[model samples]
Target chain A: MKMRMLLVAAAAILYSSSSLLMAEADGKWLARVPDEDKARVNPLAGQAKAAAAGKIIFEENCARCHGVDANGLHNRPSLRSERVRHATDGQLAWMLRNGNPYKGMPPWNSLPEQQRWQVITYLRTLPPAGAAGGKP
Target chain B: MFASPAFARVLSWAAVFLLPVPLLRAQEKPYFVTYSTDLEEPGNLEIALKGLTASPKDANAFFSPTMELEYGATAWWTTEVYAQGQATDNDSTVFTGFRFENRFRPLPREYFVTPVLYVEYESVSRADKSILEVTGHDGISSFQVNNSQSHPIVEHSLESKLILSSNFKGWNVSENFIAEKNLSNEPWEFGYSLGAARPLTLVASSQRCTFCLQNFDAGAELYGGLGTRYSFGLAQTSQYAGPVFDFRTPAGVTYSFSPQFGLNDNSIGTLWRFKISYEVQQIRDLFKSPSKRNAQ
Candidate 1:
């Protein structure tokens, strides 16, 4: 009985420590996504037409905080960074659905699913870090 | 393909309305009560100097200049104080009493339409023609003789507006429905404004230029008085419509100009409005108290 109780406490502590570490990662927001969501792929990816549509949506809805070029403004995070570039399509979509309010990002869940995918499609076209055309 | 004359006219108007819809939006103060749902950055100060000069067909020309100090108290809240004065040829220049105003936005994110609430308290003479808050003044002659008949006694009033704004396809459209009441005695009066504006260009050049077309915004507005609560028709109405031009400098200065033409005999024949403002919102990191700094 004594040994079982000791093992239970140990397991709880280990579980809590891992959660803390995961939430502390760069962007920290990455840990919030469940496995199923993190692996989903964008249906509209690589579609030039969808990307064109996304640009309009982004300008009207996202440009105020993320900036017209998606370079970020008013200390908002730049969507063209490595974290965004490396993030899976599902992860991006999930973030939009469930915003990290603590970080000042409002949920775009009100947007239609296809519209969200379209935004992801547009985002993928942005150059990675160190790209010449990126904002200074 | 060009269509018939009537169709062509309609298409031209549509093009004018739709061409700039995708341009990004920036905060700009309008000439009239047409307000966009833009809140100032947190803890920033913007000082604006604005003047409007009106010409009546057979009456004296007069101008009212107002100095407004606005502060962003929070992300969703802005507060302002105004001191107004008017001058007319062969008439005394009187310092109109001051006004206090506040605007609040309830939503945290952009939407198809955003609604903002505006409330203000003003104390001014009956002859004040700043038109900052258009209430019951319907005749052009009222503005012509405003500065001449300045009474020592001041009148207190409350004004409110339901400002509904929408940002879609990069175009921003705003409408203001206004109601005002005198503190002493009077039925609630009504007024309204409609405006549409967008930047001339949306694409930012890689090489920076100061006077680029992208920095200018051109739009038009229509506003008028809608009479009192008891009398809800256009029996004694005044209306005006005109183009507005705004230029924003990289150094945080904005200049706005507008020339308005009245549509009725009761309205002023021509009205010219100008506004210049300098904003100090960028130095937030260096300063601890912006309001205190402004006070100094």
Candidate 2:
């Protein structure tokens, strides 16, 4: 039991460090957003139906990189992380519109504005990091 | 005085320099036609070397080797340019010509049946037996004659296709309705192509492996000539069906191969085809604004 607890602690430290590194890398990407854009609110906020529709869209497209459960894959950040949870709806929307190509996240501009907002609504419903299961 | 061997050497060297370093988000397209709903990410360039060989019954065999450069101009628009050349047994090798092609998707998101418009302008010699397309080519004798080394008919033609594609349960199906018209005043010719494909695995593995079957896709293509405007029907048509495979490396190089069999006398039997592609830099990053460069 003691060895298992030590291993868990190590994994947690690794996960936290990786997340910090990712946040540092993404700082430039987030900085591009205007102050107004970051503060914008979701027009379709809390719409359960839109979120359901967005779930389908996300599964079709985003699931390849983000994983079927929106947990993330191949070093891709988990959508349920504190960073994603803290990002404003408008900021998230702006990131979707203008992707950080340098970092490999493609712009979601091809999706309709309504669909983008719907995806944001769906994202808002995900459990925060460590709420359901801890990931490293 | 370009021998096939010498040409091969030159092409191999060119491919070495043309192979671009891999980028993170580059998605490898699995098929030439019956394209997946996924589009090339904007600002990326992909290069491909495609080869196809056809042998008609008791006739001289011929093959086409083409080099293609593709650019994603936007999220919905992709453009490509091709340099085509051909070689025939007992015949002289020749550089047929080039073609420019574009594909555009109008819809922003997934639809019931996503539609893409394809247009191409080709300038090739009659001796060009690449058979990249099979339109209005229906006579058993036509294959032998069309591929005759003695005849080099220069043709400037416009080709168009309406591509309708859909995806369901990880399966992608696409159908192309084709139309071609010659600048030399020939009647419009029609053709069709259908493709269905799926990845070997729908789930990603925790460990990345270059030779993993999960990184590969298996598919099939069926295409044929639909006769010309002046003459319509399958009475004189060439049809081909084939199984295709694609292997994508982690470094962004994709290799594709196909073995096509003729379904009719008008078509050539046991045609073998292969293509290798590499992704280049995104156009946006290649030509970043001065302000962005400074910011970086």
Candidate 3:
């Protein structure tokens, strides 16, 4: 048990100092998205339950960084901001597929293209810069 | 102690219960040998227990358990440390040494075939049975001797891989080219692996419930050695191919399983492997930022 305690203590130390480096913010990724990519359309755009289905995926994959309300968390940017609210569905899809890695956001290309669009569909439902969560 | 089945079970159970308390991402791949281009989210840590059991025609049946702790320090880098152990049915269990690995993606965005560079340092005994990677005539002499005879040959090696992966529609295809060199005057070893996987369903159900078709992935991988630099062929090597399955829970837990069949005379008849992993996101923020804590 003493060894286990020592391991726990070491882990606590690591957990505390591990933050010495972490994810941060970037702005240039929006400009880097190719026009062709920006033109890609969301196939699930107008489906009635698309946003509802997207909310489930958004909560599973993005809520940790983006917040359940899509208002953003820590230093991560909010999806409810005017920039995101006005982003074309294709632009949002491009961002999801190609993250702002020059800063710290990892790409979500591992997710299916459909899931990326689904999350975008869900993002469209969030109110701008508020503490509300709804999908209708 | 770290390699025992009991210890592995305890760790897996702990991850299942403790790691799923909050929401997390679930785009993990299911391949056991081939790596894909997905890196852990930055500032997140993942803990996992992986095990392999195989009955080699040459040696006693044994189980090897590996404990892995992976951390994402940056968007393009994920680092992992592993503790390994092996136990035979009639023979005693022994703790093999450790391995440290880092995978880096230099690009800032997606490419036609995303590339990930991997480097790992391993200090393990000859008795090591995890068989994490098969490289260069490994099966010609693998498991040919008893653990007592092999355990004393402690060797240190450097392993590297060039991983290429692409996702089209809902399917993911990946390939890995491996090179390993022993620091103690051994020739370079080469290996390769290929994998393809897709989610059972592309469309997600509105409810985030377990047992949903979208939560599962099915895949397969083929891996084998390609002999040493001096003798560069498959003249004496082991090969295996197998199907893989992965189940991702909404609460940040992942379970993976595979059963591989050896494809050559030098290979083990069959191998079964399983792993359980948990993702803990932004743990630093969880501790340091009161504002972020409130938002969560």
Candidate 4:
């Protein structure tokens, strides 16, 4: 039994090492977001408190890939890029809820709806476009 | 493949020596006995060290320490391997055994209630006392046997669980129905566990703080065993209810504790548990999180 278990563990380790990471998709994923999700408005719109709360959430959950400044990191798309600045709240929410897992982002569905919205609100507070982030 | 048993052991132990990982799970789950629909994110590995101190009124108290390596096989599948050892007060200490477990999520998206499938294989002995769960007429009296005298009965078992979980607003509730069978002659045994938890506050503070209310999650869990196939009920079984709490730091570490009280005479008097976990980004060569992967 011990040997069999060892075999299983070893196989799992081998599989992980060889597993393929997220491959970049054609940047046209925006079209995949349903129209309804695109039209939805942010409930926490214009609330500084909500945006402030979201800043923390983004730091905790997103800074690794998105960069602490929310700019592009390595090949990761910047949350502060022109695309994100122009996206509707619903679109951003849709992206967070259903991550482009095929492209490497795991779904943030584990996060609560309120927190997701707070993050959206925080993103709204960032600079218009092509900026580092909201902070000075 | 490994050339020999010693090499395999070395490889397994070597995985532990390599460190540096963040626990994405700590932010989502606060219960020790029950599982939620939250699977490990793809390309992430979480390492957890948990210790259990079980106190039985009529038997010597024992402390069981467990090391778990949980890996995200994919977004829909998570696998874990556990090694455990037990040390008894005024008695001998023994290597309990190892458990391999996997959980699969069927649905790609979150719904009102999500269902996950769980299966595990345990290679252990009668002297093992991890008490990860209570199953099939398990009683406290059986735990009083001396470890030296009980280690010979090596029991191999397969256990499966139907995990139903949900997340609404900010709270997570989960229920698991368990069934187990011994490879030898034992009949099918049943068990169950339920858990519910939420962060102290759904809102996060703009500033990073270790002691913030948002960093803490509190919940409760109830678990117990049913009887064997011929006698399938809660009678002559062990049941426990406990309060669970966990604190997540800004540095990608989580600390969790639970104190469980036995509900019936068949159960142990008390059980205390503490766990610390960290996750390691697993996807490399192709992609890596912006951590210190270049050093590796």
Residue pairs clashing, model 3: none
**Would you list the C-alpha lDDT of every candidate in the order shown?**
0.68, 0.69, 0.80, 0.78
Residue lDDT tens for model 3, B40-142:
7877888777888877785677878888888776778787889898877556678888998989998778888999999999999998888888999988365
Q: For model 4, what is the error of residue A34's alpha carbon versus the real structure, in angstroms, after optimal superposition?
A: 5.9
Q: Highest TM-score: which candidate?
A: 3
Best model number under lDDT: 3
- True-structure RMSD, every candidate: 15.8, 14.2, 4.4, 6.5
Q: What TM-score results for chain B in every one of the models?
A: 0.84, 0.88, 0.90, 0.88
Native-to-model Cα distance after best TM-score fit, residue B36 in candidate 1, in Å: 0.6
Candidate 4 lDDT, tens digit per residue, B1-296?
23344334433554564354544434558888788878876666788877787768889877777888887766677889999877776676678788999987776555678788999999888888888877899889878999888887888999999999877777889999999999998899999999999888877776667799888889999999988899999999999999999998877788899999999989998899888887765443234344633321
> Model 2: DockQ against the native?
0.04
The residue pairs in collision within model 4 are B21-B279, B21-B280, B22-B279, B23-B279
User: Per-residue lDDT tens digits of candidate 1, residues B133-172?
Assistant: 4445566766655454554668898999998877554356
Which lDDT value does model 3 have at A4? 100
Candidate 2: clashing pairs of residues: B43-B282, B43-B283
- Candidate 4 residue B50 Cα shift, in angstroms, is 1.2
Better of 1 and 4 by TM-score: 4
Docking class of 4: acceptable
